[model samples]
Target: MNLYLNLPSYGTIPVVNSKNQTPNSNVLTQITSTTSPFITKANGNITIRQSFWQPVPNVIRYTYKYLGNNQFQRLHTDPHSNLITNSNFPDTVFSNSVTYSGRLIGLILESPHEEEYHSILTSMIPIAPAQSQNATGGVIDREIEKLLEIFSLQQVAIPKTFQTDEIIHIVILNPIPYQTSLFHIHQRALKGTYCTLRNNVWKCIWNIPNVRSDFHSVLNRFSSNDILINCCTSQLQPILHTWLQNLPHTSAPHLLKGHHPSTLKMKGRWYQTIN
Candidate 1:
């Protein structure tokens, strides 16, 4: 039997080892151990079944169909479907479409008598990518400014070598409550993760972690994972300032905040205030 596996550029697929293969004959015999990679044959043709271990990024429910071998000709039929409502989504806002395929194999590797049987089951699923949209142009401006600084010489100390394989895209999400999330999102974008920030919303392929101790420590108290941390509007400013002050160097936080016209320091560098 031929086994086929496919995934998106960002996803990974795992193949099962052949230790579980069993033979056709023996009326009642231990074909193979669960942990074992090799299977034993009982009679002539044995049918083995298996399932995928994990769900892909945007996979929802999937349908599997396949063809069966017959005396005269091969018979095709619809077998079953696997539903993934139990699988966890990284965030409440994200959705996606993903599909995976599984099949039985006949390879004995070292066994001289190994035979293969093809399955009649295949799967297809559709899922939505996590998404969010901002209605406020003011929010969009905040987003554009952030992007500018992201690409700015002062903000990006390291030079980015251009590569055709790199995918660069920007998307703005509404309801950004904490600066910690912004810190992570920015780091991820630099590393090739597409992310966008607007006045109130935020979205991305994945939340990148903040390497900066100031931001990382705060997030660690709540969640170590890169999900958005929602904060009340009333607490936004104070929390942001607190986090900014905790950064390794006072200048970094100030620069992040001072990007706004109203927040720009007047006379000297803003780092003096922290000293």
Candidate 2:
């Protein structure tokens, strides 16, 4: 099931640990320190010599490819799925289709675990389908303003305090373009495969590197602007119906047109952040 939320301008919410626990800073710290001796950092930027595959999300969180039959079936993502998964099953993934498993790197744009919020109460009031469907980017902002006027609503919550409590920069290594990068997933790649084997399957499943030794730096670091959110298509009527019955204003959130991963051009070093 998809857990990430994509918001315009504000940026989409990255995947969070279950129950919204903060991602462990210690884990990132340890990995970087242990590997620092081998990495050369200049001007706080670690340069890259070789390109690497970064994990990104497909629609939903699984990577897939359609067989010649055009049927979405489990195609093998890599030859070593049997190894890292330690099962005869074909779904376990150790790394993306391009490299061995390692946590994504995000440089410290903001400190991790610096503080925590009890909750964020964002009430998404719904609008007519025609009006909602027409909204995107800045247009959505204007629609919200209109809704606020109609409803006499001013803010999402009281005692307003905004905190950019999340975000860190991982020195994204030599990242290839968005079209051919690795995807982020847990059980499988989202939707169907990339329609091609190399685009869908892990190219270096058996040749994953030791973080301390194998990482190659990039000439520059990736910024939040380089991050792109990915989504896929699914019939959401059931969930939308449920939300209309249970959520605020007797309505569910609006959705944009969802295209398959094969059609998306989400940029490199793609990783989601929790909002």
Most accurate candidate by TM-score:
1
Assess candidate 2 and give its TM-score to the true structure: 0.16
Native-referenced Cα lDDT, model 2:
0.22
RMSD of 1: 25.4
Local accuracy of candidate 1 as per-residue lDDT tens digits, 1-275: 21112223323222222342221222112222222222222343222222211122212211112221211111222234332232222111112122112211100000000011111233222121221122112232233333223333234331332222222212112122122122111122211122112111111111223222322332222111111211112223344445434645321311222221112332222212111
Q: Candidate 2: worst 10 consecutive residues by lDDT?
A: 110-119
Worst 10 residues of 1 by lDDT: 105-114
TM-score of candidate 1 to 2 decimals: 0.20
Task: Indicate the residue-level lDDT of 246 in model 2.
Answer: 45
TM-scores, in order shown? 0.20, 0.16
Report the Cα RMSD per candidate.
Answer: 25.4, 23.6
Residue-pair clashes per candidate: 36, 29
Give the whole-model CA lDDT for all candidates, comma-separated. Answer: 0.22, 0.22
